[model samples]
Each structure stands twice: as C-alpha cells, then as structure tokens.
Target: MTTNHLELSGRILRSRRFDSPAGIHHTVLQLEHKSLKTEANMQRQVYCVIQVILSGERFERLTDKLKAGVDIQVSGFIALQQSRNGQSRLVLHAENVELKN
Candidate 1:
C-alpha cells in the first residue's frame, strides 16, 4: 500500500529458493548492512532483502552467481513481518537488488 519505502544495501547472509505458481523462479538474499541517507550516510547498520529473479534462460545465472560475503545494493519497501509466535520483524521487498562496492 505504500510506495514510500527506503532503500538499503548490504551483503547476503541467507539465500532461499523463491518460486511462483506460474513456473517463475527467484532467489532471496539476506543482506548484512545498509546506508540510510539521501546524500551518503555510512553510519546506518541495517539489513535488507535482496531478490534476484530469473526470466527466460536466466534461471540459473544469478542463482549461483551471488553468495554469502558478497556485497549488494537493494531498493524496496520495508514492512513489519509478523511471525506465528506474535513477534514482529522489519523486512524488505527489494525491487532493485544488485552487486556493488
């Protein structure tokens, strides 16, 4: 409902299999750090969601391309992820996730 999500960048700590009912496949990567600011703020220590989707013959291309300890940049909406135990967590739905310095 909100398009006012903040952008975050980091590295992948966790990568999971993401698939759809239409035979579309994707990979979810967990980042380790993020920068919070318009002009370049390096003090923010935030994590993010990085998803790499494969279209056409690009299925296994990005799947094994990215791994743990690799740096990445992510841009997406952040929201509260509710667990079955009633606990809440902030998660990211990365619209644009890429490799970076």
Candidate 2:
C-alpha cells in the first residue's frame, strides 16, 4: 500500500477573511483547548476544524495562509495554535459563511 498521505477530518468552529503578507483568503478552524472548568476530565481536548471563505478578490493568495483548523487527528503533528498575550486568536478566515446549530 502507498504511504505519506495526510487526510484529516475535523469540525469547523470559526471562519473569517483577513489580509496578510501572503494575501487574503477564506480561513477556517477547529479548536481543541481543554475545558479548565472540569477537574476530573479523563480525556484531553479533542480536535476540530472550521471552514473559511475569503473575499472573491483575494481567495488564491490566502489558501495556505488561511490556516484552516485540523482535527484531533492532526493535532500532534500540527503545532498547537497560540496567540500572543492580549492578542485575539484567529480561529478562521472567511468572508461569508453559514453555521448550523
């Protein structure tokens, strides 16, 4: 069988469109932060992935820069996301979206 293929599945929590040195595009996300409120938690935070939709004008450059979220599957391999103190965390990068409850 072939190897070296990476396929990840996750839930989308946030999405937004932003401008960066790379460009602007739809960015998606999945968060896995632990619930500190629970002290007797047996399981670590799971994985999630959000969807993003950048403005039509700047979709290409923001593809990779979009930084979509990975599922619990890709957490170890992918760096745990972090934001500078006081800085807001970027969950996703999309201009338009519809979330389901």
Candidate 3:
C-alpha cells in the first residue's frame, strides 16, 4: 500500500484559472512555504515554492478569495503535473483549505 497525502501552510503567491475539457472550473496557485526544521541534528531554514490546484465547488468558492500573499492552510494529495514536453513536476491537489492571518 502507498499513501499520497500532504498538508501545507503557506502564502499564495499567484492564482490563475483554467477549464477542463468537460467545462469544469479549475484554479491553480503558486504557494511559497518557509520554515525552520531540524535535520541531521542541525537546525536549518527551509523554503520552497510549490504549485497547487483546486477544482469543483472549492474552485469556485476560492477563486476570488485567494488573493496573492494570502496565508492559507491546505490539506490535500500530491499528484504529478503532466506536461507534453515530458517533464515531470509535483503539484498539490487541495481537498481542503482554510484562511489564516
């Protein structure tokens, strides 16, 4: 058995909209995450920018509310971002989201 779950809290750097072939609404966002973590007995500051996608009703509800620089907590699964160029990328498919100050 395998598991593919992710939980992240970060600032939304940007957002855009696209439609599926079946006319379903989809929202894609760029999130920036930063934190201090202890690894190998040392503390380090880690930072990363990730892509996140939202679909269905959640997409509609969050489309306008999620502005750039908004801090939010997201829980979801990780999926590959398919590209025609054969490049493999990781994307977070958000299942739940919450706004935070």
Evaluated with TM-score, which candidate comes out highest?
A: 3
Question: Candidate 1: where are CA atoms >4 Å away?
Answer: 1-3, 20-26, 34-61
Off by over 4 Å in 2: 1-6, 22-26, 31-77, 86-101
C-alpha lDDT values of all predictions: 0.63, 0.38, 0.90
Which of 2 and 3 is the better model by TM-score? 3
User: How do all models score by TM-score?
Assistant: 0.60, 0.30, 0.91
Error of 3 at 93 (Å): 0.5
Report per-prediction Cα RMSD to one decimal.
5.0, 9.8, 1.2
lDDT of 3 by residue, 6-92 (tens): 999999999888899998898889999999999999999999999999998755876798889899999899988778999989999
For candidate 3, list the clashing residue pairs, or say none: none
Name the top lDDT candidate.
3
lDDT for model 3 = 0.90
Error of 1 at 20 (Å): 5.2
> Alpha carbon lDDT of residue 66, candidate 3?
88
- Please rank every candidate by lDDT, starting with the best: 3, 1, 2
